[model samples]
Target: MNSASMHPSDTNVGMMLVISAPSGTGKSTLIRRLTTEFNAFTFSVSCTTRAPRPGEVDGREYHFLTREEFLRRREEKYFAEWAEVHGNLYGTPRQTTMDLLALGRDVIFDIDVQGARQIKSNMGQGCYVFVFPPSRDALEKRLTGRGTDSEETIIRRLAAARHEIADSQWFDHWVINDELDSAYQELRAIYLAEKTRPAYRASWQAALSRQWGVS
Candidate 1:
């Protein structure tokens, strides 16, 4: 089998890369870089009941929905995974995600731990990664430095960070965002390695089988 001839685009199955981290752990930045660098990776835009932030566009950053609409969709099981975070309801649309995967597009998720747990339970496959800050002080500094949250909200987020980190033990990989460039490299490597997994390489296997005259 000439495995070297197999290209990434030849893969018939896509990967569900689920990533979770505390609010200030730089998870969003990493995901942005990944999707930008690797054009094949698709960012799963989630539906959220929270109002869009300044300069955030609807259907780009999130599919902004009213609380009533969100609840109605939740009851219909329209979301692959949904959770309440910071008092806002957020959910990943079920059909959209499955359709992308069916088309062999690697979908990446930027969600909280609760959402990640729901995804793991509902879908047993895919890779789960947890991002951690270098230290407690660093996390606090980042949260406070944002200046977007009130003092009370910052404290609440810090507390939630602890809980999220504790629950992250079940993740398949953990990346510490001490240095942005180094962390990005490590994350990129993980995705590249995951692409080689047997489940994602059905086309490659078929090509090999044909070369060997196997049924």
Candidate 2:
């Protein structure tokens, strides 16, 4: 789609977006699928201290950091949002995200509930969505089915999910991932719908004027 055809303020094609979820809710899977399908999105890279899982690349999966490295950067106020997940710290570097958005490219953030809220508040305006599992049981099964976490970890995640779900109402939109393909379709629809919101009309008009040479 051409810029002139969109809202004047509507930078829909190139905007930072936060996709949040509790653990094992398929946020990563969904993001992977999107990155495969869309060329405009750059998955916002997050820094973390956790060891990489099998087949996960360092720069692609996360910017794996040492405890000292994370702390040093943390003290420098470099992150837009940071949090500790099971003793490992993770964060989104602020400048990288802003740089991407300034270039009119979409930065996709895959983060937990806490960091998501911080990014939304700090970024001021951007697309924020909570990815919900079909059901609690499904979440539990997915987590364990991977066999990556211990039972204790699973329970802790479930407890955390209870709080996350409570906060979903606070976000702009929600996508219940009962089925993966359907959820992706819904997410795509939401993106298009956002472009048409009244707030975006001025931008669309400006773009059109520029295109048609209307003073």
Whole-model lDDT, candidate 1? 0.89
Report the C-alpha lDDT of model 1 over 72-148, residue by residue, as the tens digit.
99899888899887899889988888788888899998888888888877766789999999998999999889889
Which stretches in model 2 have alpha-carbon errors above 4 Å? 1-13, 48-76, 86-88, 195-206, 210-215
User: Against the hidden reference, what TM-scores do the models get?
Assistant: 0.85, 0.76
All-Cα superposition RMSD per candidate: 2.8, 4.3
- Scored against the true structure, residue 49 in model 2 reaches a CA lDDT of 90
What range of 10 consecutive residues in model 1 has the weakest lDDT sum?
A: 1-10
Index of the highest-TM-score prediction: 1
- Candidate 1 regions exceeding 4 Å error are 1-5, 48-73, 85-88
